[model samples]
Target: MKKDKHIDPYKHVAFIYPDIMDFVDYKWWAKYIYSITVNHLKKSPSVLELGAGNCKMAAYLSEDYKDYIASDISLSMLSGSVCKINKVCCDMTALPFNKKFDLIFSAFDSINYLTSKAKLQTLFQQVYSNLTDEGIFAFDAALINNSYKLQKVAETSGNFNGIKYYRKSKFYPVSRIHKNIFRIYFSDKVITEIHTQKIFEFETYFEVAEKCNLYVADCLKAFTYRKAKATSDRVQFIMKRKT
Candidate 1:
C-alpha cells in the first residue's frame, strides 16, 4: 500500500489487476489480515478502513460491522473493488470524517507510507480525534528488518496484460526509508514510480501515541499472537483513544 506523491501505483495498472491479484494470492492475504484484525474488534462496531485498497478486507468483513467505510486516496482503485462497502476516496493523513468511528484500521503496512515521524504523529492525532470513546486504531509497520531484506532482494520483474514491468528496491539506512521503484513499459511510453515507506522504531510509536492522546493497547507481531519487539520484522500496533 505504499505510494508516490500520494498516488496509488495500482491505479495505473488497475485494468490488469485481476491477474496481478491472482499471482499475489490476494484472497488469502485479505482473509489472513481479516482474521488477525477482527479478533481485536468489538461486535458490530462502526468501521473505517484507512487504506482500503481494492476493499479486500472489507469484502470479507463489512457484513460484521454496524456500518463500514472503505477509503483510499485513489478513486480508481476504490472503484475497482467488488464489495458492498461504502467507498470513500480520501487521504489517510488528513481524514475528513465528522462522525466518530468505533474502529479504524489499515493493514499491509499502509502506515509505513507516512515516511516520517512527524507524519506518523499527525496521522495518529487525526485518528485519535476521529475515534469514538473506546475506539480502537489498529495499523501495522514494516521495520528496518524488512527494509534490509527488501534492499538485498535481486531485481524482480513481471508482465501484466502484455505490458512489462520491473521492480527494484533500495533502503536508505540514514533515513530509515525504503523505496520500491517500478518501471512500466506501456504501449506508447514508459513510466516510473517510486513508492516510499519509513521504518519507525518501536518506542517512537508509543511516544507519538502518548502525545496524541492515544494509548498503546497492544503490540503484536503481524500474522501471529506473539508480542512484538524492536527486532520483529513487522509489528501491528493497536491503540485506543483516551476516554
Candidate 2:
C-alpha cells in the first residue's frame, strides 16, 4: 500500500517554524522523562530519538545518557538543529538502527504523522526491535479532546530574522484531525503549506504499544511528570519492551 501524503506539508513548513521548537522547555521535559524512566528502570544509558526535528531535547537528554542518536525524516529540519549529534535520515516507521538503545523516544507529536493503524504498528515494531531487553520507548501524542479548545482562536503570526510565518489551525472532530496552514512570507517570495495530523485517544496508544510487545510503564501529562488526566492536551507515555 502507498503511504499517506499528509506529511508533505510538514516537510515544507518545517523550515518556517524551525525556531518554534525553542519554545519548548527541554530541560524540564528531559528531567521528567529521566525521572520516570529511572524510577521504573535505572540510570541513563544509550538513547535514540526518532523524528527529533530541529529540537534540543535529545541534546539535553544526552547529558545523562552515554550516547544519543537523533534521526529525522527531514534533513533540512535536522540541519537547523544545534548539537554535536549523530544525525541520521530515516523514516520513523522503518528505523535504520539495530538493537542499540536503552531508550527510544520522540516528541512534539511527531508520531501523529503516521496517521494510520498499520503505520503506527510498523513504527512500534521498529522501536521494539531496536530496543534492548527492558529498554523503554517514550513518545507523545496530541489528544482529540483538546482540539476544540483552540478552535475559535484567531490566526497567530510570528517572524524569525528574515522569515515571517502566519499560522492557522482547524480541527475536525469526526476524524480527530488537526489541519494547520502555515503561510511563510520570505524576503522575495510567499509560500503556503498545510500540515495535518491525526489525534488519538489515550487508550489507543496503549493498545498500539501492546501489539508491539511494549507495555505501558507510565503515562504523564505533557511537560510534567504528573499523572495524566482525561483532559490533558498532550499525553506522554513510557513503555518498556517485555523480554
Candidate 3:
C-alpha cells in the first residue's frame, strides 16, 4: 500500500523549525511516565520509544531506565536533536527489534499520523510484539470531540529562538481530523508547513488493542493525571501485553 503523503509537509516543517521544535516538551512528559511506571509497575526497566522525534523524551529517560532506544522514520529530525540518543530510523509499523522492551511509548499523538485503521493495526501489532511479558505500551491520541469543538479557531502566533511562527488550525468534522498550518517568519526567510492528524474515537483504540493481544491498563486525559473525559482534547492510554 502507498504510504500517506500528509506527513511530507510536516517533515518539511521539521527540517526548517528544528530549533523551535522544543515546543512539545517531552522532558516533563517523560518524568510523568517514569513516575507512573515506577508507581504501578514497580520496576525501572528497558524502554523503547517509537516515533521518538527530537529525542527529548529519550534523553529524559536515560537516567531513569536501564536502557533507552529512540526510533523515528525521519533521520533529519533525530540528527538535529540536542539529546544523546541511540537513534534508529525505522517505521513504527515494522519495528526491527527482536528483543522485547519492558515499556514502549509514543507520545504527541504520533500514532494519529497513520491516518488509517490498517496502519494503526500494524503499529499496535508491532508494539505488542516488541513488548516483554506484561510490559506496558503507552501512547496518546487526539480526541474527535475536542477536534470538532475547536475546529474554527483562527491563527495564533508564538516566538521561538528569535523566529516568529503563525499557526492556524482547522478541524474536519466528517473525517474527525485536525490540520495545522504554520507560517514561520524568520530573520533569514519565511517558510510554511502543514500537518494533518486524525482524532480517533476512544472505543476504536480498545478494539485495536484487542486485535494486537493488548488490553488497556488505564486511560487518562493528556497533560493531566485526571481520568479522561469525553471533552478531553487528548486521551493517553496505558496498555499491557496480554500474552
Candidate 4:
C-alpha cells in the first residue's frame, strides 16, 4: 500500500473545488450579499472578499462594485477564479493592503476556519484596520447545528476531470471542531488535505467583535434577515468599524 502525501489545505484540492461544491448557487448568493451591502451602505461600495476560494462568488459579486478584490491564503485557489478579477493571495488575519474597503465580506462560512478565539479577534481587528469609516464587515459562520447535521453525510466520493477524490467529514462535539479529510488521486500520487473548522457559539461572535472595537450591526439567520438563534445551523453577521 502506498502512503498518501499530505498537502496544505486547498493546495491540490483547489483544482476540483467547483466540482465538489457544484450545489452552491454563486449567483443567488452574490445577490443575497449584494442586498445586505446595499441595505447598509445604500450604494455600491468598494469590496473585498476574504477566503475567496476559487473566486466563484467573486465572478458574480465583483459586478456590483467598480473596485473589487478577491483574496485568499492559497495562491492555487485564487488561480481557480472563473473570470478576471483583482486577486490577492494573503492571510485574512494579516491583510497587506494600504487602502480601506467600504464592504468586506467572506462567504461559505469561511470565518469558521479560524480555529481559535484569538485568531478570530485578530481577523476582526484586521477588518477594523482595513475598513472605511462607515464600512461593513460581513461574514457567515457555520454553527454547531451545521456540523452535527453534516456529520451524518459522513463520506462522499466523485471524479472531476478524470481525477478521483474522496471526502470524509467528522464532528467533535467536545472540541467543537468540524473536520473534513480529503484524498485526491492524481496520476502519480494521492494527496491528502485535512480541513478543519471551529464551531463557535452564537454569542461568542458578538463578544469577539466588541473586543476588536467592531460593532455588531446585526446577526441574521443565514440567507435571511431574521434574527439568529442558538440552534441556527448558520448565521451571517454584519459588523461595522468603530468610529
Candidate 5:
C-alpha cells in the first residue's frame, strides 16, 4: 500500500480501531505529565494541548484547569477520546486560534514526527504567539540515542473487544527514524498503519527555540528531575515566549 505522506497516520487507526486505547497502559504517563505541568502553573489556568492523542492525558489533567482545549490533526483520533472537553481537529504547525493560553503542551513524543527543523521552529513561533506574555509551552523530545543508538525490536500483540492487533517498533540508525507498524486483523478486515518519529539532536531544540525567541526554562530527563543530556532517551523541554 502507498502511504499518504499528507495524511495524519493516526486518522485511519482511530477510525478502524477506536477501541485500541483501552488496551494500552497510559495512566502512569498521564500522571507524570500532570506532575510536571502542575508545578509550573497555577490552578485553573487556561491550557492548550498539542497532539493530544485520545485525550488520555487531558482527561487526567483537565480537572485542575479552568479551561482546556485539546487539538489533534485527526478528527477520528479526537473522537475516540472519552474526554468531553473543548476539542479541535487541527494541525500542530499552524494553530488556528487567536485566544492566548497560559500553558501550551504536547505529550507522547508527538513532536518527533515533525521531520524537519523548520517545521519545529514554526511550531515554536506559533505556540509563542498563542501564549500570554508570561505563558509556558511545554513539550518533550526524543534524543539521538532514543532512535539512532538502539538496536532492538519491541512489539506488543493483543486482543481487545474482538479486535486483535500486533504493534511492532524498530529503529533505523542510518536515518535516525523510528517506525511503529500496527497491524490489526479483525472482523474479516486487515488494516495496517505505519507511524514514524524522528530522533532530534539536543542542540537542534535550543537553536529552534532561540530562533523563535522562546527561552527554554527546563530540559529535564523525562519522568525524573535530572538534567537532560544528549543521550537521554526522552527529554522534556519547558519553554516560554520571550518577554
Candidate 6:
C-alpha cells in the first residue's frame, strides 16, 4: 500500500512515543546507569548521551552527573524531550563536539541502528575522539535472541486520542536485520516510517572497539552486572580509551 505521506523516522512517533513507551521505568534505568558510572569511574563526570530519543531517560539521569548533553539524529525527537538539559541533534557516527566528555553513552539498543560494521567502527572512532583520557563509552545492542523475540510479536496497533497507529515487525535471520514499519493515521493523511536495525554478532563489537583504540572495560547483561554471553537477548558494552 502506498502511504499518503512518508515522514522521517521518529518525526511523528515523537508525539506519541512517551505514551507508547509508558511501561518503561525511566527511574530504574537511570539508577542502573548511575550505579555503573559510580562503580567504573568513582565520581560524577561530564556525560554525553547519543541517540537519546526524546531525552525521557535523561529527565531521570541528568541530575546525578556533573554535566550532561542529550543528542539524537532526529531533531523532531529532541524537540519532544521531557527534560530541560542540553539537547543536540547530530549523527552518532559523526559527533560534532569540541570538548571531550568523561562518560559518553547510548541506551535502548540505539547502536543497532548503525546497520553496518563500518558504521559501527566509525562510531567507535568518533567516541574515541570525543572521550576524555579516562572517559568511557557505554551502549547496548539487541542480539539475535532479541530479534527472535521481536518476530514473535509480528504486529501491534494503538490509538492516541483519535490518531491511529500500526506497527509491523519482522526479523530476517539470514540477513540479520530487524525491521519495524509504522503507519500513523491522521485526519488528512497517513504517515509511514520504516526503521531497520542490524543484529551483529556479540564478538563484532569487541573487534571494532579494539581497532578503534578502545578496550572493553566490561560487557554486561542488560539491567544486570553479569557478563553478557552470546545467547543473551541484549548486551551492554562499556569501553575505555586505550591510552
Writing each residue's lDDT as its tens digit, candidate 2 over 1-243 gives 997753433565677665655566788877877776765545667888888877577777777875788888887778877888788878888787755688888888888887787888999999888988877888888887667776877388887877889889888878887888888887888988877788877788889888889888888897786899768988888888876
Q: Give the alpha-carbon lDDT of every model.
A: 0.80, 0.79, 0.78, 0.89, 0.82, 0.88
Work out how many backbone clashes candidate 6 has: 0
Q: Which candidate order results from sorting by lDDT in descending order?
A: 4, 6, 5, 1, 2, 3
Which parts of model 3 have CA positions greater than 4 angstroms off?
Answer: 1-10, 15-25, 40-44, 148-153, 158-164, 184-191
RMSD of each: 3.9, 2.8, 3.3, 4.4, 3.7, 4.1
How many pairs collide in each candidate, listed in order?
0, 0, 0, 0, 0, 0
Q: Give a tens-digit lDDT track for model 1, residues 1-243.
A: 856566565666555445545555546655665666576667777888998877767776675564899998877778888887688998888998899988899988989888788898899989988998878888888988878876667487788778888878888888887887778888998888777788888789999999998998888987687999899999988899876
Which number leads on lDDT?
Answer: 4
Task: Put down candidate 5 lDDT per residue, 60-152, tens digits, no spaces.
Answer: 678767499999987778888888999998889989998999999997688998878888888988998898887788888887766644445
**Ten-residue stretch with the least lDDT total in model 2:** 4-13
Off by over 4 Å in 1: 1-10, 13-41
lDDT of 3 by residue, 41-105 (tens): 53667788888877777887777885889888877667768877578877888888979898888
Q: TM-scores for all candidates?
A: 0.88, 0.89, 0.84, 0.95, 0.88, 0.94
Candidate 5 clash total?
A: 0
Model 5 stretches astray by more than 4 angstroms: 1-6, 15-28, 148-151
Better of 3 and 4 by TM-score: 4
For residues 147-189, write the lDDT of model 6, one tens digit per residue. Answer: 8888888898988878899989989999999998989898898
Model 1 pairs whose backbones collide: none
TM-score of 3: 0.84
- Tens-digit lDDT track of model 4 for 179-225: 99999999999998999999999989999988989988988999998
